[model samples]
Target chain A: MSVTAPLGFRAAGVAAGIKSGGARDLALVVNDGPARAAAGVFTANRVKAAPVLWSQQVLAGGRLRAVVLNSGGANACTGPEGFQDTHATAEKAAGLLDDSAGEIAVCSTGLIGERLPMDVLLSGVETAAGQLSRDGGLAAADAIRTTDTVSKISFKRGSGYMVGGMAKGAGMLAPALATMLCVITTDAELSSEQLDAVLRAATSRTFDRLDTDGCMSTNDTVLLLASGAAGVVPDLAEFEQRVTEVCADLARQLLVDAEGASKAIAIEVVGAASEDDAVKVGRSVARSNLLKCAIHGEDPNWGRVLAAVGTTDAVFEPDRLNVAINGIWICRGGAVGDDRSKVDMRPRDVTITVDLSAGPHTATVHTTDLTADYVHENSAYSS
Target chain B: MSVTAPLGFRAAGVAAGIKSGGARDLALVVNDGPARAAAGVFTANRVKAAPVLWSQQVLAGGRLRAVVLNSGGANACTGPEGFQDTHATAEKAAGLLDDSAGEIAVCSTGLIGERLPMDVLLSGVETAAGQLSRDGGLAAADAIRTTDTVSKISFKRGSGYMVGGMAKGAGMLAPALATMLCVITTDAELSSEQLDAVLRAATSRTFDRLDTDGCMSTNDTVLLLASGAAGVVPDLAEFEQRVTEVCADLARQLLVDAEGASKAIAIEVVGAASEDDAVKVGRSVARSNLLKCAIHGEDPNWGRVLAAVGTTDAVFEPDRLNVAINGIWICRGGAVGDDRSKVDMRPRDVTITVDLSAGPHTATVHTTDLTADYVHENSAYSS
Candidate 1:
């Protein structure tokens, strides 16, 4: 179960014939709630998708009753016509549900600069709204995949409440939500302001830390809707914890299921002057093609680590840095240390630890290795 | 006649046992000059190589008589002993020419975190000094090869003066010199300050714009040696133009000879508010892994271009952006324009032009496609 895992919520997925193969490509999630509170975070890209623009405006009202998402057209760079299409889709869903169009959010993901086939999409929306059920979470999850190899769904059970989210993204990932589509459903009795704070804090620590390919998207979005069916008004800390856990789980899933990834690498930077510096340094190392290539080759090449670190303005002395790959200290005090040949790299999970020896702060970024398969997948066609 | 194409310069390339199989790994270039005014730019990497450190100090005096380069080992991250080795190498070269060690600049390229063989290097310097000749430029160029398939040498004859240079770099390329070693010889009558200004200006427009990859090197160095043998005091603008043309030619060669690259991409960002924004936007697009993959697959993915631009803070309305692959405007006003099929990619050279439509500024960056061979080479061995 995804969104429907929470009380007072219903979900459904249906085929819209938007994808070339007639795959399931449209989804709907509804909050049949006594209390409607919603918050969202959209891509910071100056060029946002039409649906992202619509959803942002809807979420601004601090209340949402439904979310409609399509997988075969991003509706981005389609100009004002695209915006009208998004508005029409939301209004149609609202009319079918006997609700306000201002309370319906929308998201679209697929090829950019293409207008959605509104005829099929509107008809699919009517069908999906009819198919909405409490157990439709998995189906809804399947409807949002683009280049994703698998559907990403995660849920966390809090005391008398729960948080559930489903995410879809393959590549073009980085900080600031990592080019993903996500919808969160919660049955916790909380105000929209509380939900907004919790979502921002949770996302910053979770989805924003995975710098997959350093490419930000124009349609990245995450929506959280609360139904208050469980009647659990938990404290802010507990609520934030549950939300963060679910988001982190989905973030990990995104990394593990990254398109064409051969190995999942965790780059942890320690002993930084501040958390931001640590993240900056970690991101710098994680984004280096040379370092990622070395990781894919399973070569304990620590020199590239130093080279990447040197590019950052973070506080660190060149001679005071240390790097360890898979628990073997291959570089210490900025020079070669342990025997690289002894370091085993046959596993798919790789850990690179960099100690700046500057301060006590630390941060970690999750990433994947650059491989020939990745090149093949991204280069095989335009996606 | 590359580095020695200019008057009052002698160069040599000699076999050094530092590299396996006795390949020529050491080189020497001497300024048999009336004036030894020289200027250089080293890598901005905080983790400086031993040779880079030595050369920086030598250039601090605003004069240089000779430069000794080794290709098989980069004495970086080797600690105090590495610095001592660089000192010894420069001291030996100075002794061979009866000049002060402060007048000898040094450069090294190859595996980092390894010490150079002092005995072999010292002997190789002696042999290279004895082999120095005015016609040894080609041999000198050949000695600097690491992963490069060809020797890059360019010369420009000016009014009563001439400038010649050689360059070598395979990858770990980005702004701030883009990780390369270059020795420029000029017979123009100019002071060290003039050389500094001209070199910075020329490199800013040439080598700095060749961001092959986002990895900056710890051993990048570009040295300009003026022998002033032609006794020609040309105008400043004329001298700068010649130097820029030579550097630009050599930069293009570097891109053409980039390791494992099947295509060279020239990214031009126009209508930016400032030159900095133009370069920044161009670099962001050039470094996108997804975009690079699309290019390697012969996909003219202008959507990826907009996504990359959205990541930067460059001033532009999303709806006003346009992109062209080759001469085909596939995207106009951030919407689909011409058929993407109209663009052709069956060539070694590709150009991606982005019009931000914010102001009247522009910049161009040279890069290469991300290939499977690139991943294989960077990952297969610990370089």
Candidate 2:
């Protein structure tokens, strides 16, 4: 159970020939509530998909009655025709669900610069509307997968309330957001303003920090809907923390399922003058292809880490920087500190800690090692 | 004949025990000049190697009698000892050549964060000094090989002068400079100020724009020495152009010999608001691993190019963008244009022209396709 784990929400998944081999490729989530509060975040890339452009407009009203999502076409770079298709999809879902067209949001994912199968997609929307159930959360999660190997779902329980979410992404993960589509639902009593504030706070520290490949997508989106069916107002501070935890769980799942990844690596930068500096340092280190390849080979090459950090403009003296790999201080004072052979890198999880020795701010960015499988997977993706 | 092709110059290459298997790893070039005028450029990375720091100080005096270069180790991040080793090497070369220590420059390339075998390097310097000859430019080029497949050498004739150069770099190439060591010698009668201006102008458009892997090195150095042996004061503009052509030739050689590269890609951005904007957009596209991988697979994936352009802060409207692969305009007005199948990619050379349609400025960045061989080479390195 994910979105449906919360009360007053119905979701369904169905195949409509949009994806070949009759695999499920359509999902619909509807909030049947006394309150239809919603919030969303879209890709930072200026060249956004048509669905994202439509959803951004619909979400500006701070409400959403239903969300219609499809896989197999990104509906991007198709010009005005693509925008019309997204509008048509939202209108079709609204007509079937007895909701206003302006209250419906749409999302699309798959290959870029392609058009969706309109006839199959609209029919799938109707079928999903008729088959909606409280236990259809898992099916909806599975339908949005492209290269993801498993369904990502998480639920966190607050006092007399519930927060649940589902996400699907594999590659092209970067800052602002990964190439993903996520739907989150809650039964806690909250206003549109409160939901928007909480969602932004949660996603900023979770999904925004997961950069697997450093490639931003044109179709990343995350939406949160509140039904308020439980009729209980939660403490704002405690409720925000629960929402953050759920988002963090989904982000971690995305990292674990990243395309062709053999190891989940975290670059933690500490003693920065500011949070931005810490993030800058972490992201710079996370994007080092040489360091990623070295990690793939289980070599504690701290030199590559310093080289990457030196490229950034963050405040740190070269000779004062320190680095540790897997709890072993391999580089201290920008020189060799310990025996690199003593560090064990056989585990799937690896952590590289960088101490800037500047201040107290810290940040962590997650990424994957560079491998031949990654090169193979990406090289053959568009073929 | 490369560096020694110019009059009043001698060079030599020698095998040193610093390199395993007795490969040539040490080189020396001396300018027996009536006028010792020189200019140099170093890596932009703040965490520079010991040799870079030492040479930066020597080059500040605007005169250099000789250069001592080695390829077995990068002598970087070794604390005070690393700096001392570089100073000692330069002093030994100066003593052997009957020159001042302040007039001797040092350069090194290879693995970073390692100490050199000073004992072997010092002896090799002595041997190279004794064997310096006018025809040793090719051997000097051969000695600076780390992962380079072949030596890079170029020479151009002026009215009554000669300019020749040699370079060695295969990977860790990025903006500011590549992981390279280059030495240029000229017989033109020019002052140090003129040499500095001409060298900067030439490099800014050549070696500085070749970003093979988007990974800058900590030990990049390029130097030009003028001996005034020809005693001809040529026109400055024409001389600068010739120097630029020689630097461009050496830069192309570096691109052709990039580590594990299967395709040499040129990303030329046109119709930008300014030159800096054009370069920013081109470099952003050059660093896209998805685009690189797609090119490696010979899949004309223009959507990846658009996605990369969207990530830059350059001035461009999404709907007005266009892209061409090789000579086929596969994407026009930010959407599909000509049939992608019409494009041929079997050739080793590929050109991607991106029209921002924002203004009239233009820039080009050279790069290479990301391949399995690249991943394999870097992954197993230092293991």
Candidate 3:
């Protein structure tokens, strides 16, 4: 399964001179189908980019034929001019595809508070439309990238249809959806409500669990367009399951590409009185810079983890808490357990477990360790 | 006005080999009192150090004579033995000062989850006690530090009394407090209730408003001891004013010495519907790593600021919000206001102003920028 596995969809990617390194920075994907059902999730951040706002309004009716994306300028904080640019770009794509402007979605990534070059953007849209092909899915995935070291794409095969998606983000990532910009294509015949329900459920557990630095972005967007090109629609449960797999795969890929990330960490909080408590405890540890740095150094600093949990509103006796790092029980009943010297944390994957000893409720949050390279990359970028 | 400027107090500092660099790592200050009223504020973190638990219990009675602090080995997560080490250290200090062990407060900083070398600690306590002097305030201030670039000490002379304090912390500093340890001494006769009232009031506005990375610490403790040796007790009004000033000064110094700090930022939120709203908005900006990094680069990224505040529960119209960076109004009513280029942010001191246009409530939170040096220093240190 690949991004092009979805039927009745054609994609094209191009270089548009938006990025300094001449990387692919323009993409176009069109639904050449009998179905136009669409759903989208955008950044909760109030300071949204022009494209995010524009695409959100476009998706409100649950109908979309195509999407145009570019990487370089975020088109955020550019005032009315930025919104006008997004509208104009959408109109240009609409003209080439002979579709209503409102039926087209737009997304942008890269430095924030910068305006997109209208000339380059308009020309790039034309080029992308001209180069659109059924086998262009890989190119589309590559175009919508910025600081990401590689493109993120996921796919899942269903009994009658398929789900495919491409995402781009490295830092400024958090549960509120981070700075990610993603596009998903499907060949399942689904309504607006059904698509939204499945998308929300999948996102809640996938994208929402990827927290690198706990920083929300102003240009985050994820759009799903389903074209009834496969001529078959499975039951809601089956479609939802496949959707979840695709989202989870993309989310995992995003974590793997997290900026300056040395390891992918899974922080699990178990035996909590409630799921909320478990999630709260897990997020607290996921957001602790000290703990993340410790993990980066492979020090297995369970004390920092305990301290993080203590700061949460979760009910737990300090002495009753137990902690494990990388399968080694380093602390038990709120006291030091086994010798930390015996724990090995050199692997790229790390797991931290906290037993609250309250009940059976549990939750797990995915995160990445903090490293100097993360700081260097972020500080060097204008965004 | 130094730590020793307060009446009825003598302080001393010495090298104890606790710090790998052999810097001053042991400090002692005694209340040669006619009045020994005291109050304390400790870390809210659940994974507390053995010394924090001991100090908290001893301070419950509001009577303290001396405080002993070391700059290396936090003595946290060391299990029962850590508790024993804390008790032994306090006992040694009590023996030398001819006071009950419970009356002596102990604090340890540096790497977490590490055990103290009891032999070296005992010898250091003895050396600190013998080196105690009336004018050893500066040395004492220098000794109780870890990862701090400079010593933090502030003093104020009252009509007939004096107030002084010393503090140490770098990162893991936030509103609920960080890895901080502070000691305040005064020569004003006051009851335990009075001391608690004044200290709480001062802390709520001063130390609580200093948030670096939003990571609360496990060993944050602030001790205030009063001795009536000066035979001058002012009214509650004057005492509160003096205490507030001392706390404010110490808080400022802490911000100045923040780890990997390249700039000190003051985020002021005004015209909120309530003080809580103001604090929430201010803290949102203070805790945003992206905003901090943007500020570090001197990029007036007001969009990130707005995005951060948007995530808060504070009620406000997006277009009704106004923001200013470094005295230049960059955003008005949630849109571009002026030329961002005019807002020069190259200086180390940066101020962000947000107008909620809801009411008269306001709050100011102090924070530091996120930088590569911060990540480097924190990740390089092995727990």
By lDDT, who's the top model here?
1
Best by DockQ: 1
**Which regions of candidate 2 deviate over 4 angstroms?**
A171-178, B171-178
Residue range B156-251, candidate 3, lDDT tens digits: 888798899988886444221236888999988998889999999999898888888888877888889999878887888988999999999999
| Per-residue lDDT of candidate 3, residues A288-345 (tens digit) | 9878877888888887788889889898888889999988998987777888988899
Worst 10 residues of 1 chain B by lDDT: B170-179
TM-score of 2: 0.98
lDDT values of the candidates? 0.89, 0.88, 0.84
- lDDT tens digits, residue span A1-383, model 2: 99999999999999978989888999999999988989999888888889999999999998999999888888888788889999999999989988898989998988877778899999999999999999999999988887888989999999999999999887444221236888999998888899889999998898888887778888899999999999989999999999999999999999998877888999999999898999999988888888888899898888888888888899999999899999999888887788888899999999999999999999998999988788787777765
True contacts kept of 3: 0.58
Fnat for each model: 0.79, 0.66, 0.58
Between candidates 2 and 3, the TM-score winner: 2
lDDT per residue for candidate 1 within A214-245, as digits (tens), equals 77888889999999999989878998999999
Error of 1 at A137 (Å): 1.0
Provide the lDDT at B17 for model 2. Answer: 76
